[model samples]
Target: MSKLVEEFNDYRTRMNEVILSKNNLVMKRLWNLDTNTYEEGALDKKTKEMLGLVASMVLRCDDCIKYHLGKSYELGVTTEQMYEIFAVANIVGGTIVIPHTRRAAEYWEELQTNAQ
Candidate 1:
């Protein structure tokens, strides 16, 4: 795996471990809600993940961005689509999104490189 993917997986693994072992009472419910939110319904899972990516960027949540980006890739969201989403994030989030966008772009490039 690329460094970006490795980092994302490591972060997710650690967070899951912590939540499952130490914070299950409240964290498990929150995690479950999050899991449920990504299910296909009125909006497809891919669209929901794209929206989640937008929300993550606007909220300046790196972990959330990584998770959503990973899901978007898993769901076959294209790099072009990601550029559009980043554009939306840039418009909605302004200068605050610069760093997050940079990080996301780097991860996307890493994913592409590894795929090739």
Candidate 2:
């Protein structure tokens, strides 16, 4: 795995464990809701993930962007498709989203490299 990818996964996992271990009902329910929302519904996982990626980019949440990018890649979203998604996000989010797009592109490259 790429160092960036590894680091992100590690940090996310560690923090999630710490958070969940606290046994907070609200947090647990929120986590469950997020997981269930992305299941193979009528939208399909790939489409949902792509939508998630766009929303994350528009919202300027790096962690959410990376999570959605990883899920999109795992769901077999093509690079070409991702570019279209990026374009939509940039169009909707305007100039402020460009920086997030740059990071997203970098993360996508790392994912592709790791796949090979």
Model 2 compared with the native: what TM-score? 0.99
lDDT of each: 0.91, 0.96
What is candidate 2's local distance difference test score? 0.96
In the range 44-114, model 1's lDDT, one tens digit per residue, is: 99999999999999999998888888889989999999999999999999999999999999888887787
TM-score of each: 0.93, 0.99
Question: What CA root-mean-square deviation does each model show from the true structure?
Answer: 1.2, 0.5
lDDT of 1 at 54: 98
Worst 10 residues of 2 by lDDT: 40-49
After superposition, the stretches of candidate 1 with alpha carbons farther than 4 Å from their true spots are none
Tens-place lDDT digits, model 2, residues 1-116: 99999999999999999999999999999999999999998899999999999999999999999999999999899999999999999999999999999999999999999999
Question: Model 1 has how many clashing residue pairs?
Answer: 0
